[model samples]
Target chain A: MNTQAVKVIYKYEMLRAWNTILQSFASPVISTILYFVVFGSAIGSRIESVEGISYGAFIVPGLIMLALLTQSVSNASFGIYFPRFTGTMYETLSAPISFIEIVLGYVGAAATKSFIIGLIILVTAGFFVELKIAHPIWMLSFLILTCISFSLLGFIIGLWAESFEQLQLIPLLVITPLVFLGGSFYTIDMLPPAWQTVSLFNPVVYLVSGFRWSFYEVSDVSVELSLLMVLLFSVICLSIVWWMFKTGYRLKR
Target chain B: MSSIISVSNLSKVYDGGFRALNDISLDIKSGEILALLGPNGAGKTTLISVICGIVNASAGSVTVDGYDIVKDYRITRSMIGLVPQELTLSMFVSVWDTICFSRGLFGKKPNPLYLEQLLKDLSLWDKKDNDILTLSGGMKRRVLIAKALSHEPSILFLDEPTAGVDVELRKDMWVLVEKLRQTGVTIILTTHYIEEAEEIADRVGVINEGELIVVDDKEALKHKLGKRQMMIELEQTIESIPESLWTWSLELSGNGSRLTYTYDSYSEHTGIAELLRAVDKSGLLLKDVNTSQSSLEDIFIGLVKVNNEGSA
Candidate 1:
């Protein structure tokens, strides 16, 4: 209901993103481009196809999802963490704004930044590999939902992390490995039967698989299951955030 | 005058059983400056935080304009603006955007003219487009004051506002504070400097060991608790005080070369004339005489010492 408050917080965050344009936007675009060169040109020459689609085109959705997940988590986490670190959070906490409004402001801005990066990476991916959206609506929905869910997760991490090491811990040791092992660059079908079963446990698999289905109607898991998993993860993150605010965990003392 | 904020029987115990506040009760009258004076760890900041709704009370309650702080947090919070002790700011943010954002966060409509006036009032208009990192420490403190006032809250809490600033800036801050009072905003400031309280506060509250030991009109507190001392230097050194002068409750120092008489200043007759006449009659030759009154600092130290000894 406090749209003005949300707008102010969101604008301030977005301005910070623009201030660090290279780190926020350019770095991801360039990294995705490099991934195309190394994966599409170097490795694609050895393996021409993944399933029926060309290997170069096959990883496009996964790469975008990878970037989306990382950027959403890091951006949102840093957004909240920096405020706390500098003690400027008192300004927002003492304001007349509600917790929901605060969340909407911070999380909304993080998702928008990640969403933009995801779309840009998708376009950059198109330059190296021929791309198609089998279900454009589903692809956009999946992209947006992934951004929101991951940003919420990042918001929780921002609250829970007590130090800089802990902030980077989940993203580096946990999230990156899950994304790479979740079949971002290769299909789980290429893995042996036992390995594929192990890969199914990784949550990033559901996100990438669901997004890939939107792109080429091919995925490691069924489209319905992927959507359900994303929805469930979103619900869980929301509940945790709601509880944090209600209990004044980290945000208040 | 009606009280704008009331805190009753408030107490706060941190997670580790550290009792930061103990049954504090205070009322802040509208449009008056109330200064809370305490030593380090006396719970001055904690008291301000509770009334501002930044910290939750373990027991009891606080109300702003009769609205409960916890149940009606939004309404009560909207009425208060806090200038915290820390210099916390987003360094990359421009001064203009910072104030504007703070105003919007309070759900206020855009008022560029008012904001312009605020900037001008704080002498920050020239630096409006500059990043906060480029500003000096004093300027940053001014920006904080500006941000707190951006929403035009009726109640302002300034915690150690002049802690590290120079005397010139401290004077300017008080001038600005007086200007704000003219607009009918209630101000509550906390300081360890008794002079700061003496300079600006209409009423002074001395808190020691998490308990408000005294709250009274500044002048009245001094008048009631203050002591006057009269020192007389003897023409010759004497080993001990004469038995006749002992009736005056005198203290002999400087190897009996000086005598000090302590008395209540508020009493109609200080009995100083009698003491002098008695000294003369006792053949105590006086070389020089001087009188001095105890300051707020002395009274504060005395009160804290008493409180510590009582609890010990």
Candidate 2:
């Protein structure tokens, strides 16, 4: 994989990114805790078992995916966007650092932040309701893949964006809505056949299914298909990133 | 000596059809400080951007230290460090950390001694642990310079590096540049301020309306295009110019305290002595005589004005 370059960039950017996250740490942590109390304990009584699992247990994977997706986008977008807005990207581009190094640094940072957030939510979810992992390694794999995929997607969006408004457009107007409609809160099986068929089209569904599969040994879709989707998305994102760097797209030109 | 940077037929026509750099070409000698001077939109920044590979050139080829900028970008880029006009740093990072990170960007291993020396040179060693945002504007500018130098490149490009900096700090920067040049680090700088160029440039290149108007040695550029103005403070107020003084194209001050005469430095006869004799014959008392030579700024304006008139 020749990840030596990626690893160094990842380490430096991750350490610095964690420093940045410290600012929003208290807020997201408190907000997620409040979400558990309000939705898991307060609302769980009204809802019956979802696919034979408790409502609290069913929403846990969805909530973790939700947090992972948003944080990945925001962290990656802001990480690259601020430098571009402030004109520091000029310094970066002029340096000897290859384009691959830059992508690794920024995307790695975003992925790491999301991974940590996913873990925190996982541990937090465990406090409210006991979680039984059918395959812990698969769960971690899916989590890492999901984080890296979204982070790379966010990096592209950041580069393509010119202004602060443009940077926020993808995360707010596009990603948030897609995650919500990706069947995070309820099972697709409960929906009418047509709506469930539509829900399957959302790419986020694969991620949620993969994460949920690790927990209950059950999923809306086959685990192999979900993992394949993740790999496909990763390949597509990497190609786009590689093209942006090679052409010196928005960053250089 | 072999040229370090060879720019041939470089042109940058921005998306708006405004030609920022038009067919500009020059050979920058190894280890020389070449100053690019121009008015706003004269393509100084655009030129440097192309050479540093920061901005794409519409048409042209540049070779840095014999490596093609487009094909051998890694080697070319690694050879040059740029201190941009904008002072942008990772505001959250410490001064020392920022410099080290920049060094690592060039694939250079961390040399603690070199890093310490670079920090000490910029007087940033004292503030090494401080976050970038906490520093003053002058200090931030210094940090930018330090970051650019951290990679130990053979060539350095400074785009208005001293803009908004204090006079003392500006001098400090020049001194550092002088030291760097002595160490065989070729320097290229773009500045709207003429005095900065006059102070350090070995050769001066002027661009106007995206065209390279002239490139010459500092002394030669001044001598070739420079003009001198003779200011004759009159003894008393006068209502009109004397007919005999008309040949000199003299301009009389409204208050009659001064008479101005413009002459080419290259001309054999300035007509100054004859004009003085004419003044005496015309019975005008000359209170005082003072002479001033043209500056690079004057020459630059003169050249641009000539180009504009020719185009018109």
Candidate 3:
């Protein structure tokens, strides 16, 4: 429909997210640094090189995905949740803006935050270990795609949440565990063959592997498979979000 | 004026088995103020929400300026402005930013001059740069009004626009409302304060228990349903009412110094003469006579009570 309206919404929503970027910077950056300090310095000593890359550098991409995923989900979820909580959701729903416009605006903002966090973690990891970029464009593409996919997922979570506690549940309980068990600190190859097959089923594995492939040119999974998985997740999440808007689900209720 | 909003057989039944709005229907004319008056849980909010397209109707059709609410939602929503009752503003956003953002939400380009004028009119110009959280409750309420009017919709719905405001701000809001009305903006407001409707509404609609019980011109409804009371100060104290004045339906005060006679104003016969004759026949000299008329509040209470009793 109105592309200009969506752009305007995206611009302002991005600005709103930027306005609060500093508040999140302290915690997320500190967490990333701790990951680097503990995993790169302490854990890397005992764990030798895996897949010909240093343990410190091997975990960088996974850590970045972790940052991207959690920040993307939190920022987008809170972006929609606070508005609904404060009653500004009424203003948005009643606006001439379409559902795509609203989602794009919010997801764009969330993705931006995730990108910023991802960048911060990337820079932080560089201080501890040497980083390589095998395909800079693919890295950026996967970064954006993963951010958007999880942001859409977060947007849906925000709509379904009735209170602040419910809003915090997903990022704390669901995404954190998924990221931890998604081959962030250890490769799936380190697991038993059966566990490796099971880990292949974890969606975060594809995201982390795709990000790792972008950096070191080596991944537990194929880059093409990881890209396809990210694309598929993005499409499915986008469709569900679109359906929620069309049905006016919890957003209107 | 032609009708600007038409709602037919609108109803909303929640999954909890509560009928939030029952078969409600009403037509709002352009360039007029229609006050939806009701107590809490009377479906006033639900009616406004549905018409504004914020809530879906279970079974009904609503057309705003000939655009269906559901089928042509974008156009219909663009034509309507709703000032919700909740104090739900972005606390960190500046006042000017909030209004401009709201205007942008309607796909309107930024008009700094119009925004300046709107802020000035609402006495929010001085606080344009101030974050919304820094403003007092009254000023935040003003910002909410500013945001609602930012889009410049033709029809405005204010849900309890002045529920908990100081007298000065309420007066300012009423003045602003009058100015908006002067610009041919049709306003439909829901309020628990009957005096507000009595003061500004061209027509008043009363809803009770999810159903619209009455809709009439403010003064006309007052005249049609209003009751009158005549209090007479008796010259001498009486232990009880006199049988001679029983036909007058008079009641004696506890102190026996006053007599009150209640009568319907719309009745063809007021029976004041017959009551006076009987009072004289009873040898009770009236020391003083004072008359009082029912207000919109009285009429609303009476209508709601009658409707509830009838339904029960």
Number of backbone collisions per candidate: 0, 1, 0
Off by over 4 Å in 1: none
lDDT: worst 10-residue window of model 1 chain B: B48-57
lDDT of 3: 0.88
Candidate models: Cα lDDT each: 0.91, 0.86, 0.88
Candidate with the greatest lDDT versus the true structure? 1
Q: Candidate 2 on A60-133: residue-level lDDT in tens?
A: 88888888898888888877888888888887777666667788788988888888888888888888998989
In model 3, residue pairs whose N, Cα or C atoms come closer than 3 Å (at least 3 residues apart or on different chains), thus clashing, are none
Query: For residues A1-253, could you state the per-residue lDDT of candidate 1 as single tens digits?
Result: 7788999999999999999999999999999988888888898768868878998999899889889999999999999999888998888878877778988999999999999999999888888988999999999999999999999999999988889999999999988999899889888988999999999898889989989999999898999999999999999998999998778788778
Report residue B11 deviation for candidate 3 (angstroms). 1.1
- Model 2 alpha-carbon drift over 4 Å, by segment: A1-12, A20-26, B229-290
Ranking by DockQ: 1, 3, 2
Candidate 1 local lDDT, residue B223: 92
For residues B1-312, could you state the per-residue lDDT of candidate 1 as single tens digits? 998999899999988899889999988899999998889999999988887767778998999999998888889988999999989998988999999998998888889999999999999999999999999999999999999999999999999999999999999989998999999999999987888888988999999888999998888989989899999999998888888878889998988899999999889998999999999998989899999989888888999999999999
Q: Supply DockQ values for each candidate.
A: 0.77, 0.43, 0.60
Give TM per candidate.
0.97, 0.90, 0.93
Give a tens-digit lDDT track for model 3, residues A1-253: 7554666667767777668666666678898889888988898878889888999999999888888899888888988888888888888888777888888788887888788888888888888999899999999999999989999999989888999999999889989999998999878988999989899889999999888889988888899999999999999999999898887888765
